[model samples]
Target: MSKHPKPNALIWLILSVVVIALDQWSKAWVLRDLPEYTAIPVIEGFWNWYRTYNTGAAFSFLSDAGGWQIWFFTGLAVGISGLLTFWLSRAARGDWRQALPYSLVVGGALGNVIDRLMHGHVIDFIQWHWRDHYWPAFNLADSAIVAGAVGIALFGLFDGKRSKKA
Candidate 1:
């Protein structure tokens, strides 16, 4: 039998909860304070608080799927979150390289899932645009997920070499 030291799963769980709370709270605040398709400039030419709902996947793919996409995305989020939680449990302490990313992903997935379950779609608000082109609206959770994914990828690339030498 192999004795593996479990990571500080509690920390990950707490962080995940905090992420979910912040994500939900911000969405709720936006829903209450902002109107659909309305933009409130936050940084002039850089960003704005714009309310929009996504019924599809990233970049609004399949957004016009006639509503079936709502359930599909919801289910996908839930599934991903579940898998992340399981992964977190198996992670070893001091393995922030892996656990941190999993935690972030879990948080983001749950955040969007809550929106889908409650609003029948995901509420997005943050907007970025250049002089002419506008980027897709997103929320904090999406940012966290992207950051975590990048961390994981970078760490994997660098850590692989170190592990090979050990």
Candidate 2:
């Protein structure tokens, strides 16, 4: 009988823990130190540390849906995180390309879920602007989610091409 090395990427979950810790810590700092709705310029004419809250998804989508969105979004994030975690458990230890993105997304999703369950909304602070036009405020969790998503898409595309070539 030949022995097999079942090295799974569960170790990558450490990155998820780090992301959650940072996201929660920054949100706590924002709540303690920042003034709500006031923009404090971090980079003159470009970025600001703006405290805000969102009850909905990105860009405040369905934020005013009469409080039901809290459960909706919370459930959705939890489900997605669970799915990604399952994927991580199946991924190979050497497959950082898949493991990394899954970990990031799981961390980001759970981070926001914590806020939703505790405060009924997600805390946001980082803000970007172009002259007078400003972008919707978001937090580190959102950043991780976006980065992970982009990595998944871009890397998956490249991997597909490589697979076809081989």
Candidate 3:
């Protein structure tokens, strides 16, 4: 009897490529058009196209640790992306839940990685704020990473509950 091989979610990697493209393109635009350390108002009191740079992990963690944090973060992102790619290979073709989040993480991680390698810092442009408080500046890659992390956490929680009920 002839048997065909089962499909895998590796195809979802296309999303990763798309994410990387968009993230890079946006950063390029910011570099070319946006002024550094200045807020170009987008919502009068809420948002702006504020260009900035980060050399460390989320929320500028370790951003002031001299210079070694750059390579450390780059290696960390690459390692995590590699691990996610491996997981995607093992995921079932129908498992969008697993593939999607993993793909997002890879895309986001690699996108920022490109920045770190080329510019020695990740370029950030989008900014949100109120009258007195402001969220840290971030980029599309950061958004994707946050979304993916949320998906992984939420879906994993649901999965755990499902298995428990079963």
Candidate 4:
């Protein structure tokens, strides 16, 4: 390991904090402002502010599993976050491309885990639709996780090519 890590690692950490804060804050605001399963239009047909509580994983999978999934998911999130934190601590500080995605994942995981622990379910508020079809409602933490996944994928693809050329 280098004696000094990359400066951008700090930036990644800051970004992770911001993501977690914003995710939790937005969820808090929604809980205070909206009723359960209520939709408030944000962009007419394209988007809306809708509140929902998901007790299961994506798309409400295992949501009706008689409540055992709450602890299971919570445990998974805690484990994943711990592993990510360890990776982040060992990562080169300047390697923002590598660190940022993991940071985002860690932050997002914690954000949702907080909700699960506090409310028995994760709050989701953003909704999108097209014609008669609708996408499942999700929150900022979910967005961050998806974005982080994309970032990591892109970095793996492009960064490897660039490094080999250099």
By lDDT, highest first, what's the ranking? 2, 3, 4, 1
Q: TM-scores of all models?
A: 0.91, 0.97, 0.97, 0.89
lDDT of 1 by residue, 1-166 (tens): 9986654564677777888999999998998899899889999988999999998878999999999888888888788888778777777756888888878888888898888888888899999998768999999888878977888899989999899999
Model 1 spans with C-alpha error above 4 angstroms:
1-10
Candidate 3 local lDDT, residue 153? 97
- TM-score of structure candidate 3: 0.97
Q: Name the candidate, 2 or 4, with the larger lDDT value.
A: 2
Please, what are the lDDT tens digits per residue for candidate 3 over residues 1-166?
9988778888998999999999999998998998899999999999999999999889999999998999999999999999998888888978988999999999999999999999999999999999879999999999999999999999999999999999
In candidate 1, the residue pairs with backbone N, CA or C atoms under 3 Å apart (3 or more residues apart, or in different chains) clash, namely 7-93
Candidate 1 TM-score, C-alpha based: 0.91
Q: List the residue pairs that clash in candidate 2.
A: none
lDDT per residue, candidate 2, 1-166, as tens digits? Answer: 9988698999999999999999999999999999999999999999999999999999999999999999999999999998998888899988999999989999999999999999999999999999989999999999999999999999999999999999
Best by lDDT: 2
RMSD of 2: 1.1
Per-residue alpha-carbon lDDT of candidate 4 for residues 1-166, written as tens digits (9 for 90 to 100):
6685444354466777888899999998998889887779889888989999899988998989988999999999889878777777777787778798988888888889989999999999999998779999999999888888888899989999999999
